[model samples]
Structures are given as structure tokens and as C-alpha cells.
Target: MGPDIRTQSLTKPVTVAEYLFTRIHQLGIRSIHGLPGDFNLIALDYIPKTGLKWVGSVNELNAAYAADGYARCLGIGALITTFGVGELSALNGVAGAYSEHVPVIHIVGCPSTVSQRNGMLLHHTLGNGDFNVFSKMSSEVAVDVARLNKPSEIADQIDHALHECWVRSRPVYIMLPTDMVTKKVEGARLADLIDLNEAPNDPEREDYVVDVVLKYLHAAKSPVILVDACAIRHRVVEEVRALVAKTKIPAFVTPMGKGAVDETSPEYGGVYAGSGSQDAVRERVESADLVLSVGALKSDFNTAGFSYHTSQLNSIDFHSTHCTVRYSEYPGVTMRGVLRKVAERVDLKKLTRVESPAVKNEVKKNYEDSKTITQAWFWPRVGEYLQEGDIVVTETGTSNFGIWETRFPSGVTGVTQVFWGSIGWSVGATQGAALAAKDLGTTKRTVLFVGDGSFQLSCQEVSTMIKHGLDVTIFLIYNEGFTIERWIHGMEAEYNDIAKWKYTEVPEVFGPSPKQVKKFIIKTKEELEKLLKDKQFNAAKGLQFVELWMEKEDAPRALKLTAEMSAKHNVRLED
Candidate 1:
């Protein structure tokens, strides 16, 4: 990661692509995901040279999604695409990262500067001779856009963009012209790594906010801590855990915050998603005397179609940019500093401790004897099969909502597009998560639960995963249609139906594995249980695929509740 070395001494100059990738390598990004094209082929050559692995994806869109998932696991991720068509295809995935506050660097390669300035008709252009349209579109979703047009300012632009991407935990765009890829830059610049530390909160404001939070926290008779997604994105999981433990109050998680808190804790309450939650969880959260909201991103789906009844007056919200103690807001006071201070300064003796409600992932016996798998039984059953070090990835449809019922082990990591609710995300995300887990050597397995309908969009990434020999387990649920959409809209419409492809043929159609790929089809709960207990399957020595046949109309209780609420809201008259 240091400056270049020659025969006798360190070199002084290097290519722009070399400098860029070297900086990315220092950020702990071992793998770069993207598709190669005429424009980016030259840049791809520099990736391996910088001691980074190049993951050639099936398409630009999957590459972007893979980058997002990789960022969630490894803290930051990067992807490269070529020119207008490639960049346009990756926009939706990048927008999801922006919506969820994931840090991803999107680098797009374009035609030469001479070609752009002369308004030459490029193959991917719209025939209007405009080269800035795609970049302008990306600006909407990216926190910062860095164009490497000037040789002198390129280093600063790249540094600033990467800095913003990390500190803000959102996507950033970097445009590299073909000619700029080979342009010379000072090698000495690589010696000094870019500053990626988060900005500190103002001491005066932080202390004041902490005092206000303590004032309310000490007076409450029955207070509970509510955790959400931004706690993970802002790198404050430790602080959140510290406060929860030191305060000895019951802590709960939202759907998007499943992996933020340890479920094995004695004070850990079940998930709270308004009307979608279980009766006990809903009553416990809504009836709390004071709610310590940690990094809450209250999207409609996350809140069960905005059914949450907790008023702003009784809640104290902690955000990365501001801290809200009831009606008073303190700007420049972040949660990381204030949470730690409160945990250190507060007197737990004066606080009331409410016992966490009894919560367990117990499978109901009603469907225990059923022939076919129902969502009611399947999700809870999965809890028994999941291991501690597993990374569970879910699609935006059934799996996202269904996972609310599956109690995970202590060290598990959950990945889902809850806020964005984009279909077919789990397939690509599973691949990225597998690679990230493998890279970090921190997880035992990466598994995905995707619907048969949503699996059609980015299924080709399974080939990319196979090529990399990623040890992934895929659970393809065959239900004949988008059951989630049926719950929200037309139930019997043909538009909701999907082709019943031979899903077991994926390994044969895609590249044959470096290691043997195993496939299975289970129609009954007995078969699924047998497969789950199989030692070979649990080992996850290689890629494994399972096709589970289930009833179409049935869904998880959480999705059923939220979809019905969403259906009524969809037809509401304009206010």
C-alpha cells in the first residue's frame, strides 16, 4: 500500500488508475465488482496490480447491488462500469445504497477527453452529443461526484469523494475518462492515506444533549431502548450496545435493525414494527414510559405502513447529525459521542428496569403436521437450522418480512432491502456477502431465501459466484407467483405470475463448480427437516441449492399485516 519501488529506490510517478486503485486497496477493499467494457478494460488491469481482486459480474446492475452488500459487511465497497449504458443500468442499485446509507464507490469509465469535447457520436450516447447526462443523473443519488478531468486536481477530487462516501455512509460517483486512466500522477500521493475518520461532535452541544437525555431517562418509570439501521451505518453498534447494557433497560429492534442488537441478551425484546408486530411486542413498545430511539429511519415499510403510534413528544431520537430530546433539537450533536457519555455518566440506580417480554422462535404445532410448507411454520423452522456465524440474505418480498419471525443466533448478520423494497436483490447480495464473509474469515456461511418470481431478475450472478467458488446456500421458494404483490394488489392477475423454470438446473446451466455443487427439492416439511439436519449440507463445504415447494397464497404474518394495511392506504382519497 505504500509508494512504488523501483530497482534501487521508490518510484515518483505512476498511472492515474494505479493511484486510484492503490488508494482503494488501502481502504480494506480486497475485491472490486463490476463488468468490463471497452472503456474500463484498461482500468481493470490495474485492479490486480494493486493487490485487489477483480470480480467480473454478469451485468452492471448486479455489480452495483453486490457492491452495496459488500459494503454492508466490510464497511465499504467499490464497483466500476463503462460509459452511458453501463452507468444507467447500475443507477437503481446505487440509489438503494443512498436510501439505506450504505457506503459504495461507483466508478464509471468514459470515452477519451478529445472524443467528448469534439461531441463525437459515441455508440452509447443518446445522439444528442451530450456526455454529461448520465453523470448528472448519478448526482441525484450520490453524496459527491468526482470527475477526473484535470490532472492536478484529480487526487484531491478522488480523496474528497472517498472521504464523503465513508463519513456519510452513502454512495459516491467517480468518473474516469479513458485517456485519464493512463495519465501520470505523483506516486508520493499514495504514501499519505486519505483521512476517513468521522467528524467529531461539538463538545458543548454534545454534553448539553446528553444532560437533557439523562434528565428524561432518569425520570421515566418504564423506559425501553429502540434500535434501528443507522446505528450500523454510522459505526455506532458498540456505543449502542454499551448504553443498552449499562442502563439495563429492555432493548428492541426494528425490521431494518435485526442484526444491530444481540438477540441472546436477557434484556433483548422482540422486533417492533407497529401493527405488524406480535401483540406482546406492540403493547410493550407503545406503552413504554420513555423510548430511547437510536438511529431510527421510520420508512413506511419499516414501520408497517406508518402504523407506529409512539408520539414524538415521549421519544428521544439520536441521529448522526442531530440529537432530539423530545421537542428540543441539538444540532452538531451525534449519537456516537452522546451515547457513550450517557452510558458513562448516568446512574442506573435511579432508573427503573422493566423485564423483557418472553420471546422465542417456537414453531407452531398447527402446521407441524402439514404436508406442504407454510410461511407461518417455515420461518420459525429456519431458526433451528441457522448457525451463529451465518449471514442470512433475504429478498424484498416474502423473506424480508418473514425473517422478522426467525430468531437468529448471536453472531449472525442479516442483509435485506427493507427500506428500498427492491425485488431480486437477495440473489446478488448473497454473492457479495459470501465473498465478504470469505474475505474477512468472520462468518461460517452465507445463505439466501428468495422467491421464485423475484429470482428471475439477477439470477445470472449465481454464475459469477460459481466462478469464484463462493460457498453459498440458496433456498429458492417455489410459490408460483409474487405472493407479496397478490397480498397488496390483484390476487389472481396473470401479471403477478412467473415462469416455472427448472431451478435445479442452475449449476448445470451456469459454470460447473470448481467444487461439486449440490441441489435438492423438498415438497414436505419432513424433507426440509431432514435436509436441515444433514451433516453434509450443514458443513457448507461448497455451493448448495434447495428448492422448497410451498403454498402460494400463504405469507408470513408480518407481511400479511403490512400488506393489508398498505392496500387500504393505496386507495385513500387525496387529502
Candidate 2:
């Protein structure tokens, strides 16, 4: 073996593009999504040959969203696209993913160094000789923004991007110039890594706060845990569940954290801040003696605009930035470690008498009742229509309402871009999710409930669907505008309204193989029923698009309640 070393000598050194591709592989990226362009030719050439799957999208925006959905299921998401136009189009999705704490690696290809120096207007540019659009948006959305100015910066920038993802729990951006792709430089480490470092709390404050929290929990006759999206984003679900179990507290989760604890838990009361919530659940939360808000954001929608109708008697607020006790002059240490320590001291026998079989029954009853509302009614019906194994991706609008109302059967899964609440995300994300489901060998169907406005923004993904021959169901809620915005801000008759589509004609417009693509126009509830009952609709092989015409004036449960509550307080709303 030693004698054969010289005979089996290695070939010539690889280019920077080869090295970068190798690094991306080491980062555990299953696929790279985006459209190819002149500027990014080098990375594009290296991508497929290096063994990374290329999930090419029809456009940059859809590519970015697909990457986001992929990242949501699989830890890290990545997208590769050309300079200015491509990167700019993708910025919104990246920003949304960042806000929601989705880890995404953005590989943008820019013009060659010589062209940039000459100040030439590149393709996808706004007549300006710069490809800095993402840089501008990242000023607001990204946790960290680093430009790979030199070839030497690539390894470090990638490392920094991953670090930002772990520490800040958000998206990070890395810009790669076309000129730098094959440039020679010293490469650092070839992969990303994250290690947890336990930092000590301020001893004086930690002790005081721990004592107060313990006394409050021990003395309280009724204590409950309130979990939110923050808990999920922080990866603290186990920690929070441990705390709840130790304290023997009944747990009520925010709408976003619906699945944090099993819906079947004996101590679980259904979610408290969404369409499914009942007046009784509201009353229960408002009356509890000790409310441990573990990683709660208290968003306007979640808190009913912070009305404080909930029991303010002994509120323990735990947020990433601050921690405070009710009516306390001095604040306590952050919930970061205090929660774990608190969980360690709990008495599990402190179970409350409130845990009744009735609560569990009510969860089922509430789901049925919620289906009457405009937002939720669709999903319940859609659920009946769904096959045994299906993946439903919901957009940010009436589509989300439908998913919220629809219960997932044991083998089905649901996804939403809930963290950022960005409109037009579902259509693009659905393509990505479906692609993922296909790769996993799950014979489940992939379905999307997207809004008219959202579809208009990212509809180009239809081409990708056609190209891949993916069997996906796309339901476009044709409300003609940003339905959720209209409900929230009452910007009725504004530009938020969308132009209608001959929805059932989409596949025809895109050129269809009827086996792989079909479209439906459903106007009334009865029409929807007929569509759902039609076995052919579910069994059709290509891309099936269902255009459901929703009432433009339909109001969601939360919106209707908020309006009523506001009127009761005489809060003025602009017409």
C-alpha cells in the first residue's frame, strides 16, 4: 500500500468553485435551489458535478421560498441565484425566513470584478451599476450581513452566517462575486458547527428572582404554563415541557405553538389565542393565579392588544430581552437559564383539579364549531377531501385560516411561514415542501392553500411544477386581494385587491399534460363539496390547481372579535 502511494497520486488542485461546493456539501445541504444566470455560471457548473441536487426554480423569489420551506423541515436552507435581479427578487423571502428564525444560506452571484469596477449596469439592475438590493433589505431583516469581498473571506463568512443562525436564531446572507468563484485563496474550515456555552447569570438577581418565582409557584392554588412561538424558535420545547411537568401546571399554548405539547396531553387545554379558542379558555387564562409565560411575545393578536384582561395578579413575564415579575420594581434575569433551574425544583404532585376529561372533549367540539367561520370552514372540508397521506402548506391569509381549521390525520403534515407572516410565501413554499416530500419516498400527496395575492407574487413556480412533473394540489383562494390585511387594517378598496384569475384554466395556460395538471373553479360551498367528493380531483397525477372564490368581505374569527371588542371600547376605525 505504501509503495502504491506515488502510483496513485492525486490530480491537480481544485478551483475555488470546487472548494466552495465541497464546503456546502459538508454543511449538510441536501439540495441547492435557484435559477442559473450568466454571473453565477461557475457555481452552477460545479453544483451538479459535486453531487448536490439542483432544485431549480422558475424564478428567484420562488427559489428563495422553496429554500425556506426546505430549511424549515431540514435544518438549513440554501439558494443560488444570479446577481441584482435574482438576488433582489429573493430578498423578501429571505427577510421573512430570517424574521421567523429560519436558517437560510443565500449564495448570490454577482458580475465579474472587472465589470463591477467599470460601473456597468448589470442585468437585473435598476439602471444603477450595483447589485446591492439584498444588502439594503438585510439592514432590517438579517441577523448578520457579510460580503465575500475577497476569496479569503468565503470560509469565514460561511462560518459567521451559521453562527448567526444558531446564536440569533435568524437568517444570514453571504454574497459571492462571480470573479471570486475561481479565485485562489486559503480556505479555512470546510463545515459549520454550533456549540452551546452555558453563561452564568447575575448571581444576585438570579437568587432573588428564583426565590420569588419558587414562592409564587408553591403558594399558588392555580398555576398554568403559557407557551408561544418563542419557545419553539428557541428550541426550548423539552425544557418548557419539563418545567410544566415538574410544576404540575396545566399548559395552554399560543396559536403558533399548537403542537409544542401533544394535543392529547391530559394537562393540555387547547390553544388560547386563535380561531379555535373559546370564551371559557379565555376566562381560564384571565383567572389563573400564577401565569408562567415561557418565551411569550405578547403580540397584539396574541394578547388581544395587551388589554390585560388576563389575571394580572402574579404574572411572570419571560422574554428574550427582559424578565419581570408583576408589580416588581426591579427586573429579574432573563428566562434563558432561570427556566431550566426552575424546572429542576418543581413538585410534580402539584397537579390541579382543573384537568378534566371535559377539556379534551371541548378541543374536538371547538374544531367543529370553528369550521363555521369563513377562514376555517374551508380546511375542515378540505381535510375530508385529503387522501390518507398528504402534506398541506398554508399561505399567510385565508389559506392559513383553512389550515388552522383543518385537523391533520395521523399520517399527514402541515407547514406555514408563521414566523414572519409574509404574504405570497405559501405558493413558493409549497413547491419546495412537495419537492422534499417526494425525496423522502413518502407516497403522501402535497397540497397548497395559497391566496390570490400570494399566487400572483410567486406564480412562476407553476413552471417548475410542470418541469418536474410533481403531483401537487394547489388551491388558490381567489379573494382578489390581501384578505388578511383587509381584515386587520380594514384597508378595503385599496390596492391590496388582486385581479381575478380563470383559476381552473391555469394548467391550460401553462401547457398541461392533463394527467399531471388540472384546474378547478369552485365558487360556492356546494361547489367545493362537489369538488372534494370527486375522486378524480385527488387522483389526478400532474399539478392540480383549485381556484376557490372566497367572499371578499368575509371576516375571520379573530378579526370579527377584535372589531367587536374595539367597538365596545369606542375605538375608531378608518373606513
Choose the strongest candidate by TM-score: 1
- List ranges where model 1 is wrong by over 4 Å: 1-11, 364-366
Model 1 error, position 44 (Å): 1.2
Model 1: lowest-lDDT 10 consecutive positions: 2-11
Q: How close is candidate 2 to the true structure, as a TM-score?
A: 0.79
After TM-score superposition, the amount by which residue 175's alpha carbon in candidate 2 deviates from its true location, in angstroms, is: 1.4
Q: Model 1 lDDT vs. the true structure?
A: 0.89
Clashing pairs in 2: 480-498, 515-542, 516-542, 516-543
Q: In model 2, which range of ten residues has the least summed lDDT?
A: 356-365
Tens-digit per-residue lDDT, 1-575, candidate 1:
76434312425777889989999998989999999888888989899899999999999889988998899898999999999889999999999999999999999999888888999988988878788889999999999999898777787888899999999999999999999998777788788989988788878878888888999999998899999999988889899888888887999999999988888888888899999998988898999989999999999889999999898888999998888888888888888899999999999788988888876777875365668888889888888899987899999989999999888888888898999977887788888888888778764698899999989888999988888888899999999989899999988999999988999887778868546689999999889889999998998867898999988898988998899988999999988
Best by lDDT: 1
Local accuracy of candidate 2 as per-residue lDDT tens digits, 1-575: 35534223423334567666666666567678888888787778888777788888888888989888777655567888777777778888888787667777787787776776777776666767655655666657677776766654555665666566655566766667787776654433443243423345687887677777777887777777888766766667778877766655688876555556544456666557632355666667767887888777655445443454565456887655456777663343667777877787655565343551224221333343322224546555565666655776877756654443444443455567654677778877877777776666556688888878888877877877777777788887777788766655656766677776666776577776766777677777667767777887767467888877767777456545544444444555667
Looking at candidate 1, what is the lDDT of residue 137? 96
